[model samples]
Target: MQTDNSYANTFATDSDAELVLPSHPAQAREPQWLAFNAELAGQLGIPESLHTTAAGLGLYSGTELPDWIQPVALGYAGHQFANFVPRLGDGRALLLTEIIAPDGERFDLQLKGSGTTPFSRGGDGKAPLGPVMREFLVSEAMHALGVPTTRALAAVVTGDWVQRDEAQPGAIITRVAKSHLRIGTAQFVAHKITQGADESLRQAFADYVIARHYPLSKDRKHPYRALLRQIIDQQAHTVALWMSLGFVHGVMNTDNMTLSGETIDYGPCAFMENYDPNAVFSAIDRAGRYAYQNQPGIALWNLARLAEAWLPLLAKSGESQQQLIEAATELVHEFPIRYEAYYDQKMAFKLGLNSVTAETQALTRDWLSLLQDHALDYTQSFRQLADTLETNVEHFEKMQSWAAWQQRWHKLLTLQGDSDAVVSARMRQHNPAVIPRNHWVEAAIKQTVASGDLTIFNELTQVLRTPYDVVPLELSRYAEPAAPEKRVTRTFCGT
Candidate 1:
C-alpha cells in the first residue's frame, strides 16, 4: 500500500488519473512558445508550498514527475445529468495535494487529463493537447473577467501520446480550485443509506462544506440547509456573471457543479458571439439541455438532485423530508428572481443607470434590441456605447434612440446629481473594454497552432487581462466587433 504525496501531506488521497503526454516534445510547447502563458501570476501564493514534482513543462522541462505522487481513488456518487449513478469518482483524474496558503486559504491541485482511473468507462483516459491549452486559455480569461471560477495553474505536454481522434498525443493540465467537493460527492455517500444512514451522511456533508467554504455557518442546527442557501446564492451570482458576459457552460451536470459555486468542468463550454441566448456548443447536448439560456434552470435542477440525496436526513414520516424538499425547492424557486435581478442590475449599471427602473428597463432593452437588429456584436456594442456616449456625437446619433435615451439618462442623473465625468467613469467600469470574443479566440488559436505565430495570442491575452482598461492602442483592436464573415456561429468542445 503506497501512500501518495497527498496522503503524506495534510490532505487525503482521493482519486488518480493515468500519466499521459503528447507525442511530440515540440508540440507540447504550443502555449508558452506561441501563446506564452505568462507563467500564471500567483495571486493566491499557494502552489509555491507544494514539494514541486516533475510535471514536465513545454516539450519537457527537467521537472521530474515525482515517483511518490501516487494516484488516489476518490469515492463519491451523484445523479449524472438526470440518471442516478451510484458510483462516479474521478474517472480520469487524481487528487494532487492540498496547499495551505500563507493567508491560510487551502487550494487543491488536481491533475486532470493525466490518466485513467477505475471510472474511465473503457474510454481513453488521456486528454489531447488542444483541450489542455483551451482550458488553460479560457480559465485564465475567466479569472481575469472577475468571475468566480476554477483556475488552471499550469499545462504540461508530457512527452507521451495516446491515440484519440487520429492518435493525438496526450497532455497533462494542473487545475487548481478552492475545493474539490461537489454535489455529487455528497449524493454518493447519501445513496448508501441503510435505514437512517442518509441523515448521518447529510450531517457529515454539511459539516464538511461548512468547515471548508462556509465556516461561519457550521454551528447552526440546520447547517446543511444553510449551506445549500449559501451555495444557491453563489451559484445565482455565478450564472449571472456568465450571462452578463455571454459565457455558456455547455455542460452543467450535477456532478460537474461544484459546491464551492465556482464554475468547473469546462468540458464543453463557449461564449456566445451572436447572443442566441439558447446557444449550445457541447457535441453531446443534442436536446439543448445545457444551453446558455437554460443555465439557471439547470442549476436549480441540479440543486434538486442534491436535495434528494439529503432527504434521508429529514425524518420518519417523511415529514422532515418534505420540509427539507421545500427548503431546497424554495431556493431553486428563488433562482429566477435572483438571476433576473442580477442581470438587470448589471445591465442597468452598464447602461449608466443607478439601478433597474421602468425607464432604465426600456432603455436597456432598446439597446440590446438595436444591437440584435443590426447584428451588432454583443460585447462591443455595450463597451462602445459607453465610449460613444462620452465622445462621439455622430456615432451616438446614428443609433436612433440614443438621443432620447441620453435625455432620459440625464433626468435620472438628477437622481444622482448627474456629473458627466463621474457618470462616464462609473459606466466604463461597468462595461469592459474587452472580452474573449469568439472570433478573436479562434484567430489566436489558428495563429498560434497553425501558423506558429505568437503575436495574436500575446496581444489578446494582454488586452484580456485588463478588461476594464482603456488603452487606446489595445482597446481599438480588442474592442472592435468581429468582421461579419468572421463571426463564429458555434464553438466546439476541445475534446
Candidate 2:
C-alpha cells in the first residue's frame, strides 16, 4: 500500500500550540502480540513484505518512522459529557500516516496508547491490556454485525506496565479509520475562528474533509451545507444500527464522534444483556447522559457542534450569518426524524416484518416493552424469535406476555405477505446470535490481564467473528447471558 500525509502536511499546526505538540513514547518495548486482524489487512492490500513477527509489532509504536511515513499528533476540542472543553487532542495517540490501498481508498493508520503527546495533560500516555483487548473484540464484532466502524489492524502488548488504579500491563492498538476527523476537530477549528483566524483556514479544513470523505459534496452548490447533511445522515443511520443490536456507547463526546460516522472510541462501550432503554455501562456517566436510549439525541447534539464549526463556510456565498445558522439548525433538527426512520426499519426487520407501519411499530414497541418489563436478555430475545417460529414454543416460557405478543406478531407476519421461510430468514439476517457480552468480555480480560493466558480471549474473538451464524455446541457458552452475579455492572474509560 502507498501512503499519504495530507492531514499532517496540510492542516496540522507545526507550532507548540495548546492542543498540538511533538512528543514520543517514554518507552517502546517488544510487542507481545495478542492479535492482528489479517482479514482487514488483506482488504487494504497491505503488502506481505511489511509483515512482522508479534514482537516486532513494537516497531510501529515508536517515533522512528519508515522512510515513506510521516507522523503527527492531532489537535481538537470536545464536550466532555455536556460541558465544552476548549482543547483536547491526541493525548496518547499519533497519526502515523494515511495509507492508500490498491483500490485507492484512504485509511488513517494511527497508534493508540503509543505514548505521550502534548495533549497528555499530565496523565500517563498509555493503555492497559484490558481496554486494548476490549476495543479489538468489540470493533471487530461491530464489523461482523455489519456496522460501519474503525477497524482494528493490530494489537500488541508493550511488554511494560503502567499504573492505572494499580499497575497493569501496557499495550498498544493500531487503529485503522477512513479518517480521524471528529466533530471536536471542527470545534477546534471554530475555536480558532473565534480567536480571529481567517475564513480561509476554515474553508481549507472543510475542503480537506470534502475531499477525503465526501467527494461528491465538492461539486455541490453549497458544499459545506452538503457536507453537514451527509454527516448528519450517516450518524443517524450509525446510531440506529447501534440501537438495533443493543450496543451502548458509554461516552458520546464530540471528540468521540467521527466525521466518517464509524464508531471511533471504544473506551467505555458495552452491549446490553437486559433490555432497559436506560442501560448505562460507562462508570463515569453518573447522570446517564450517554445511556443506551439517549444515544440518538446525543448524536444530534454532537452534529450540531459540527454544524457550528462550518458556519463560516456556509455563509461564504453571501448568505446572512443568521440565515446560514437557521438553515444549518433546521438540518440538525431533521436528525431525529432520520434516526427514527432508520431505527424503525431496523426494528421491523428484527421483528420479521418487511415494512414498518403504525401496527408494525406497535408490535415492535410491545415486544420491547415485554423485554424491558421482564428484564429479558436483549440479543437472545430477538435471536430466540426464530426458534419460536420453528418449534411453535415460547423461548421464555415463564413470560405469558411473550406468548400473547407472539400471537400478534404471527398475525402481522401473515398480513405482511411473507412466508414463514422468508420472514424467518430475514429475522436471522438482522438479529445476531452473538454479541460481545459484558460478562464474557470481562472474563476474557481477566484471563489475559491476570494470568497472561490468551486461551479465553482467542476463543471469544473467534466466536464473535460469525455473530449471525449458528455456532457449534462447544462454543454455545458464548451465547448464554451472564448469571446474575457474573454481570458487569459498570465499565471504565481505561484512561
Best by TM-score: 2
Error of 2 at 440 (Å): 1.1
In model 2, residue pairs whose N, Cα or C atoms come closer than 3 Å (at least 3 residues apart or on different chains), thus clashing, are: none
Residue lDDT tens for model 2, 311-427: 767665668878888988998998998999999999999988999899888988999998888888999989887787778545477785867887888898888798888988999
What candidate 2 gets wrong by more than 4 Å, as runs, is: 13-22, 54-56, 316-318, 394-397
lDDT (10s digit) by residue, model 1, range 115-231: 566666685556766666667667878888888888877665555666755655456677778877788876775665542342444565566678779986676676666666777
TM-score per candidate:
0.83, 0.96
lDDT of each: 0.65, 0.85
Worst 10 residues of 2 by lDDT: 14-23
Candidate number of the best lDDT? 2
Worst lDDT run of 10 residues, candidate 1, spans 17-26
